[model samples]
Target: MNFFLETLRFIGLCLYYTLEYIFLLFIPVRKKNVAGEIVLITGSGSGIGRLMALKFARLGATLVLWDINGEGNKETARLARKIGAIRVHNYACDCSKRQEIYRVADQVKKEVGDVSILINNAGIVTGNRFLEAPDLLIEKTVEVNTMSNFWTVKAFLPAMLAANHGHLVTIASMAGLVGSNGLADYCASKFGAVGFAESLMLEMAVQGKTGVKTTIVCPYFINTGMFDGCKTKWPSLLPVLEPEYVAERIVSGVLRNDIYILMPRSLYFLYALKSIFSTKAFIPAAEYLGLFTVMDTFRGHTKKAEDKHQKTGTKTPRSLN
Candidate 1:
C-alpha cells in the first residue's frame, strides 16, 4: 500500500513538472542575483572562458580566472579590470594536473574567500581518430577535460555543501551526448564530464541540498579557433556558435539555475530523438546530419591563433580547450 501510494505521487509529480516546464518555456524565469558572488572560472585566459569573465565582471561578480597560459590569463584580468571589475584575480594553473588544481584551489579559498560559483570551463580536444591519436594526447584530454572537474569539486564543494548555497557549472559539449567521427578521445572525455555533472547534481538533490545548484552545458561547435577547421553540413540548423553568444547564454543560465543548457535550441529536439528512436533509426539521422564527417577537415588552432585559444600544448599534439 505504501509503495502504491508513492508510485501515484510520483506520477502526479511527473505530470505537474511537465506542465511547469512547458509553461516556463513560454515566459522567462527570474534570474538570481550573482552580485558580490565569487565566481571561479577555469580556462578564463581566452575564448569562451575570457568572455564569461567579462560578462560576470559586468554583472558585479568577483572573478577568479585560471589558465595554463599565465600571460593570457593576466590579459583577461586586465580586460576585466578595464571594464569596471575591481576584484579580479588570475592564476596560472594547468587543469591537466590534479595537484595544481588542488593547490590553486586552496590558495583561492585563503586569499579570495570561498568560491560561490565554480565554472569548470577548462577542457581539451585532440581532434584525431581513435587509432591515429597519440596516447599522451588521449591521457591529457581525459585529465584536462574530465578529471579536472573532479578535483575542483573536491577542493571547493565542502564549503558549498556546508553553506548549502553555490552553483557548479560544467561547460561540456554536444559531443558528450552523441558520438562523432575522428573525435574519439574528445567525445569520451566530454561524456565522462557530462555523466559526472549529472550524477553530482542528483547526489546533491538526494542529500536535500536545495541551495546547491548544478548546471551542465552541452554546446555545439563554436568559432573560437578550437575547432577552426571543423564544418557543419547544416549551417542554418547547427551553425558554429559565437564565443560571445555562448558566454552570454552560459552566464544567463547560471543565474537562472538551469540544470541543462544545450546550444542552438535545435539540439533539444535532436537529443530527444536519440531516446525516442531506435539505433537503426538514429544512425541514418546522424549520418544525414554529417556527424560522421564533421571532423574530416579539423585543423584545430594554427600557430597564430594558439594565443586566442585556451591551451598550450607541445609541438607533437595539437591541444585546444
Candidate 2:
C-alpha cells in the first residue's frame, strides 16, 4: 500500500511538472540578478569560456578567470575590463593538475572572496578513434574534462552549502548524452560531467540547500574553434552554434535556474528517443541523422594551431582547456 501511494504521488508530481513546463513556455521566466556577485569561470582564455566571462562581466559581476595560458587569460581579462568589468582577476592555472586547481582556488578565495557563481568550463578533446589515441592524451582528456570539475566543486561547494546560495554551471556537450565516433574519451568525460551536475543538484535539494542552483549545458558542435573543423550532418537540424549565441544562452539559463540547456531544442526529442528505444533501434535513427559521420573531418583546435605554426614557422602554444 505504501509503494502504491508513492507511485501515485510520483505520477501526480510528474504531471504537475509537465504542465508547469508547458505553461512556462508562454510566460517569461524572471532572471535573477548577478550584479556585484563574484563569478569564477575556468578555461576563460578562449572560445565559449572567454565569451561567458564577457557576458557575466557586462552584467556587473566580479569576474575571476582561469586558464593555463597566461597570455590568453590576460587578454581575456583585458577584454572583460573593457566591457565594463571593474573587478576582473585572471589566473594562469593548469586545470589538469589537482594541486594547481586547489592552489589557485585558495588564491581566489583570499583575493576575490567566495565565488557566487562557479562555471566549470575547462575541457579538452582528443578527437581520435579510441585505439588510435595516445595514452597520455586520453589521460589528459579525463583529467581536464572530468577531474577538474570534481576538484573545483570541492573547492567552492563548501561556501555555497554554508550560505545556501550559489550556482554551479557545467558546460557539457551533446556527445555526452549520445556517443559518436572518434570521441570515446571526450564522451566519457562529458557523460561524467552530466552525471556529476545532476547528482550535485539532487544532493543540494535533498540537503535543503535549494538556494544553491545547478545547471548542466549540453550543446551540439559549437563554432568556437575548439571543435574547429567538425561538421554537422544536417545544418537545419543540428546547426553549429556560434560562441556569442551559446554564451548568451548560457547566461539566460543561469539566470532562470534552468536545469539543462540543450541547444536547437530538437535534441530534447532525440534524447527521449534514446531513452525510450533500444540500442539497435536508436542506431538507425542516429545514422539517418548523420551522427555517425559528423566527426569524419574532425581537425581540432590543436591540429589547426599546429598546421598554422607549420605554415608561419612559429611554435604554437597549447591551451590547458
Candidate 3:
C-alpha cells in the first residue's frame, strides 16, 4: 500500500483501540462462559492456586490440580468437588522438573482431555538476600517459577493452537516488572515468567490465533504465607493483597480476556512510573514506598514447620503452594 494510506490506517486503528479502552472503562466487558471447560492449575494445593481452582469449580469448569504435595493436592481436589466441580483430577507432580511436567501433562491429555485453560501458578521464594541465599535454592526458584512455565506451555500449547481456543494465565509478581531488595533470585524468576508470557502472547497474535488468549498477573505482596512476615510500608497505598481477592480478580480477568491484571490498582501507576522516570529518580520513589525494606522481616516458613513437612513428605503449612 502507499505510505499515505498505510499511515492513515495506522492512525485510525490507534484511535479505534483507544476509544474501545475508554468505552470499556465505564461499561464492563461480558465475561465468557467457562462451564464444562477443562482448567489446569499448577500449585493447586494451597494459596492463590487453590483459591482459583475453587472459583473455577463454582463456575462449573472441570478442574485438574497439580502440585508436589500429594496430600495437599488431594485436599484441594476434595474441596473442589465439594464446591461443585463435577470432574476434579489431582496429580502429585513436581513442577520444577521438566520431565515430570511432560509426563503428568501426557497423563492429563489421555485421562482428562485437552485443557482449555492453563494457569502456571506454581512458584517458590527463598526470601534471602542475594549473597546470603543458598545456591541450590536459587536454582530451584528459577526451575519452578520460570522454567516450568516453558515446559507446561510446550506440553499444552500445541493442542490449543490446533483448536485455536485456549487461555494461558501466568501468576507472576510485581517484582517481575520492578526489582526489589532481598529478592534477587525470586525477582529474576518472575521477570522471566512475565517476559515468557508476553512473548507467547505476541506469538499467538502473529500466528493469527485470536481464539487463544493470555493473562499475565503481576500482583504486589499477597498475604498467602509466602511472604510470611513481610509488611507494607504504606498500608493504605500499597497494602499487602489478599489471596482470595487476587484469585477472584485473576479469574475475572481471564474470563474477560484481559491481557494484564496488576492488582491493587495502585500498581498500575507504579509500573507506569518505571517507564517514565529515570533509574536514579525511580529508585528514591521505590525506597520511599518501602520496596527496599519490605522483606526485612520476610520469614517465609518457620524451620519447625519445614522440618515437619520434610519428615511427613507434605507441604510446609505456611508455604504458598
Best by lDDT: 3
lDDT per residue as tens, model 2, 1-321: 699999999999999999999999999988999999899999999999999999999899999999988998999999998877799999999999999999999999999999989999998998888998888888998898888999999999999999999999999999879888788999999999899989999998889999999999999988887887888888898889988899999999999999999997888988988888887887798788887877788888889988888898877544333
- Superposed by TM-score, candidate 2 places the C-alpha of residue 280 at a distance from the truth, in angstroms, of 0.9
For each candidate, what TM-score against the reference? 0.94, 0.96, 0.93
Go through the candidates in order and give each one's C-alpha lDDT.
0.92, 0.91, 0.92
For model 3, residues 6-98, the per-residue Cα lDDT tens digits are 999999999999899999999989999999999999999999999999999999999999999898899999998887778999999999999
After superposition, which runs of candidate 1 have C-alpha atoms over 4 Å from their true positions? 1-3, 302-321
> Which one wins on TM-score?
2
lDDT of 2 at 277: 87
Query: What lDDT score goes with residue 300 in model 1?
Result: 73
Regions of candidate 3 where Cα sits further than 4 Å from its true position: 1-8, 302-321
Over 38-82, each residue of candidate 1 has an lDDT whose tens digit, in order, gives 999999998999999999999999999999989989999999999
Candidate 3 pairs with clashing backbones: none
lDDT of 2: 0.91
